[model samples]
Target chain A: MIKVQEEDFDVGQEIKNLTQENHAIGGVASFLGLVRDIASNEEISAMTLEHYPGMTEKMLAEIEAEANRRWELDASLIIHRYGRMEPGEQIVLVITCSKHRKAAFESCEFLMDYLKTKAPFWKLEETSEGGKWVDARDSDDTAASRWIET
Target chain B: MKILYFAWLRTTIGKSTEEITPPETVKTVSDLLDWMPSLGENYSSALEKRDLLRIAINQEYADPEHVIKPDDEVALFPPVTGG
Candidate 1:
């Protein structure tokens, strides 16, 4: 299942829900994208993120489906937040459950990689020297493309 | 005719969303970008470089040559930097 929300979730509870009663599942691999308040000399004070209402969720669901098709995943979850968020906030969470560690690990990373590039989300950061707009990084696209080979 | 902008685009466009109807000749998304500079200086500034901007039509990443219409919902943004 896929869930996209602005509220913070209990990571432990979510993991338990994914792994409970499934004896065939050997391990659960998860990745949490924590927003770091990197007080770089870049002068960024606050950050605001925006997403396409119907599109964002759909794209993430597609990514999850792809991972499931490639690996023997029992369950997968992706949750993302929108609106104004401070540094150190949890921006994204992805979990993958499979019978083997390799599939779980690879699928978790694959989901994050796809979300970083394909998912529709925008970020606006406020800095001391005035706010500057951040463009999407080309490197992210390259990162996601690597997964298509597998 | 729904147009969506995000990130620096929101600042550069000075507005997040707008509705517009273009001429019959403007068939592709590239045509829309080429026409945006004429709308105002702010649009020209934001669209300074077409190479850096990404385009999506109807919520899917589209080619520059993709057909566009006044009824289509087009979105513009920079590449994904979020992790």
Candidate 2:
């Protein structure tokens, strides 16, 4: 499952909804991203996330499909939020369920790594001084490249 | 064709979207990039750093060599910063 919205989500409720009927699923791994109150010693008041509407969903679905092909995942979910959000607010979520812990854990990590570099979303931080767009980190590209088949 | 801009690109270009009809010589993403700067100073400034920009055709990532159809939707933006 995938969702792109401005509203916040309940993590516990999402997990329950995905795993309730699945008896074969033995393990679930999830990750939640939150807006930070500070960046580079400056206090951040808010963050505005921007994204391409149709492209965001399409890329997310492709990423999810790749994960399913690589692992034995019974279910997976990715919920990414856009628009203005205050510090400590939930920004994104990724959950993977499998019959074993290893697959669940690894796939969960894989989904996040890919999403960070491949998803069509941008974050602009608003500080006391002014708003600035966050730069893409080289480390993120390195992380995503690790999953490429050699 | 419809050209869309996002984030800082939109801010820099001063518009979110625009419609244009390029000449037949503008066949690919690379060709379009080369010709866009001629439109105005804003386009030239926004697209000055070619490596910093990313492109998508009809919502999918496209390389510089990707062919552009007359009715295609092309988008240009900076690298992603989402989780």
Candidate 3:
């Protein structure tokens, strides 16, 4: 499942909904991203997330499909939020379920790594000085590169 | 065709979307990039550094060599920073 929305989500409820009827699923791994109060020594008051509407969903679905192809996953969920959000607010979520812990854990990480680099969302931090767009980290590209088949 | 911009590109270009008809010589994504700057100063400034921009055709990532059709929807923006 995939969701791109501006509204906040309930993590526990989402997990329950995803794993509700899955008896074969023995393990579940999830990650949640939150807005931070600081960036580059500056105090951030809010963050405005921007994204290409149609492309965001398309790329997310493609990422999810790749994960399913690479692992023996039973279910997965990706929920990414856009628009303005305050510090400490949840920004994204990734959950992967499988019959074993290894697949669940690894796929969960893969989902997040790919999403960070491939998804179309961007973040702009609002500070005392002014609003600044967050730069794409080289480390994120490196992290996503690790998943590429050599 | 419809052209879209996002993030700083949108802010810099001063518009979210626009419609344009390019010449026949603009056959690929790279060609389109080269032609866009002629639109105005904002287009030139926003797209001055081609490497910093990413492109998508009809909502899917497109290579610079990707062929473009007259009806295609092309989008340009910066690298993603989402999880």
DockQ of each: 0.67, 0.92, 0.91
Best by DockQ: 2
Model 1 alpha-carbon drift over 4 Å, by segment: A39-44
- Per-candidate Cα RMSD to the true structure, in Å, reads 1.8, 0.7, 0.8
Alpha carbon lDDT of each predicted model: 0.83, 0.96, 0.95
lDDT tens digits, residue span A1-150, model 2:
999999999999999999999989999999999999998798999999999999999999999999999999999999999999999999999999999999999999999999999999999999988989999999999999999987
Docking band of candidate 1: medium
Chain B: TM-scores of all predictions: 0.95, 0.97, 0.96
Which ten contiguous residues of candidate 2 chain B have the minimum total lDDT?
B43-52
Total backbone collisions, model 2: 0
Question: Candidate 2 docking: what grade?
Answer: high
DockQ of 3: 0.91
Residue A37's lDDT within candidate 2 is: 96
lDDT of 3 at B63: 97
Query: Per-residue lDDT of A1-150 in model 3, one digit per residue for the tens?
Result: 999999999999999998999889999999999999998999999999999898999999999999999999999999999999999999999999999999999999999999999999999999998999999999999999999997
Q: What is candidate 1's lDDT per residue for B1-83, written digit by digit as tens?
A: 88988777777889989998777778899998888888889999999977888898988889889999777889998776665
DockQ computed for model 2 against the true two-chain complex using alpha carbons: 0.92
